[model samples]
Target: MIRFGQLVRVQDGGEYGYAVIGDNQGDYFTENFGAKPAWSPTSKGTVLNPNEVHHRKTVVEDQTITLFIDGQQILSNTMDGLAKGIGAFGFFKDRGMGSVLVDNVKVTKITPERPVDPDNEGVVPVEIKSSDMTVRLDEAFPRVLDYTLTNGKKMQGQPTKIDTIKINNVDIVPEVSLEKVSENSIKYILKAINTENKINADLTILLEVKNNTLEFSVTEIKNNNTSQKTNEEIIRTLEIPNHSLVSVNSSETNANVYGAKISTDTTVNGDTLTEVTDTLRSFNSNYMYAVISNSKLSASMHSNSQYSSGGGANDFVRINPRVKEFESYNSVGLSSSPWIYHRDVMFNEQTLELPEAKVVITEDANDDGVVNWQDGAIAFRDIMYSPVGAESVKDLVAYRIAMNFGSHAQNPFLMTLDGIKKINLHTDTISFTKRLW
Candidate 1:
């Protein structure tokens, strides 16, 4: 069958039903073929009824395919072989003497279903209902936006000018200043003055909701700057609802960028923390660490080298999801090339977005199917040495052991030697018990 420039083949098998995109050899139809049947034919002889109208329709969105017969759903399957798309289509019997009756065949493009807003359960799409939403900014010049650093340091930034604050292209300011633009989207722009030289530049912040997750992005535009300085810093802060505060799971370091990148210090909930540090030479030699609990999640960034050059900008976007905590931060690096770093933090607890490169935490790192004293020793060895490596390795053997042993712990990297001894005895006990059994 072909529709709207896509091809699909349907084969009819007696008794078993009908199959789509399957081959009929010697003109004899069989149950087994290329593609499965959309709907198994239950007719008396597996033959089309001459008195009744048989209607078939197939809908293809991207690679997903769905088939319908006589207004009744038969089956939906995807096949790459039918990718040639809609073109010439017809029916014919090649082998045994047979005839296929012609009927009215029609093809049309399928209309896309409306997308649901994640934030607002049943609210209309933001782009379609523009007038219902409004965005506003303070009209006052030199507006002060305050922020607190991860290290308990207080800082302030001033917006020298308000470029525009828009919600769905609708100008909303002064009289109806909003605490938030909308549940699903928020966008604002302003010219802010950096604290260092008081230089002015536009700061743009865009918030979008996708896949039941909210993403926040910040960008610094220095196109109007005349300063000869090679590096500079610009900071902008916005207050979101306190209830939206969740765990801080990841932080991305833009090379040559340094200091606490995104911190939830200003929020009512104090547990979330994300930091990134970079200097002229090297940064983030030590991977990030997160302390998670039922109620809150706290994370801190550690760098083997000290921060200096005092430069670069940072942007942090938080979303949802967690997987393989040990393998989360395997990449530790320093690069000379200037790049804007962006890291996605997943918040949805139901989704375990596993990393491509992951280090498994069983004493069975070698996958021998058994845990023994030797495995314990290997874990210790990795704990003492393997925490450093390239950013792209994904799975760092050393960090896996350290995470299992809980070494170089919270705050000042405190080592817990007792964890190793406990694991050692536990492994020994297991091995001895297994031998006896």
Candidate 2:
């Protein structure tokens, strides 16, 4: 897991010692695991500045492994079978804005080498498109439903049965299609329209599924018979399980399965009833859930614990007044961390003292009441703003090292500045002070 400059590795169930690569004060070598520690590790490096390049290398021989930064050894340790076997290496970064880079990486194999097949190099050919285009929800990639648009143009999509919803007193039917685009990805297309009815509009949605996540592009809305466009394309992403299908019961035709009603910037028929999404929900033998994370019936969440709304900043801030505080599901609201960070900073900077409440590095900050984004944001703000003094610098470094789990690139801040706010309604708390608006 990663946050800002920090990188952690738990090899062999952490018996090989958890290694952290980045921190505010600098890189370090320690056997720290589990929670974030408060004090500094004796073996640590200097602070890492953004865009500042540093040469890092690691060598493992027998039971000993050493880490070096800029030609200087920072950490070295010996453990039983620390360098024993082959394992997969992966790089991970948390949400919002953190990254890692590797250049001119050279690996030396001291162990025996295995022979490779020279005949074809054992490389499988990339499958561009799947020819098995049968329409089924349980199949590989299904073209499940078809619909006729307001222009009488028919399109297909992956939903086993297209759901329907009434908007502006017009019945709109949805269409879905899932296609296998490559060996590792599938393409999804969604459309909604009203045929020979009071409403004359078409919504086109395109998405790509890679691994366990879904990447959604901007939705296109064409006002039929008019020279006006209601919705523009925008990029959005969500995480979901592969081999899942959106299913809606035929009985609940008018019931909203996953769609949320949001006011659009564009107007249709002189009415600003344009912005919204068609509902998409997953189906199995046991249960059904929403594919779009921000939907009331959503099944997945972002790394920052925010619902994955498809697009448009307008819909994100609108909080559903019906949902109660303790309700885990069906609560529609924008995440309150980085989105409101600037306001929180200003509010706290004016009303409260810096570090008003105790900020713990691990999980919780402020020692207020609970563990949430407040702690994460506090730690992140220190790194982002660069508080002065040696103790502040050390605290920043310690915070980075402390965030061993459940951290994101954005939306974490110190507790004093962090508080709750409603997204749909405007306030100093939930209002987005940045350019995101």
- The runs of at least 3 residues in candidate 1 whose Cα sits more than 4 Å from the true structure, single-residue gaps closed, are 1-183, 194-196, 230-287, 291-437
Residue 431 of model 1 has an lDDT of 18
lDDT of 1 by residue, 293-312 (tens): 11111111111112122122
* Candidate 2 RMSD computed on C-alpha atoms after optimal superposition onto the true structure: 26.9
Candidate 2: segments with Cα more than 4 A from true spot: 1-162, 165-170, 175-178, 188-191, 195-198, 227-437
> C-alpha displacement of 247 in model 1, angstroms?
7.1
**lDDT (10s digit) by residue, model 2, range 149-256:** 223322222322124433333444445555565553445444445444424544343333332223333234344534222222111111122112222122222212
lDDT of 2 at 309: 31
Clashes of each: 16, 23
Q: What is the C-alpha lDDT of each candidate?
A: 0.28, 0.32
What does the lDDT read for residue 26 in candidate 2? 61
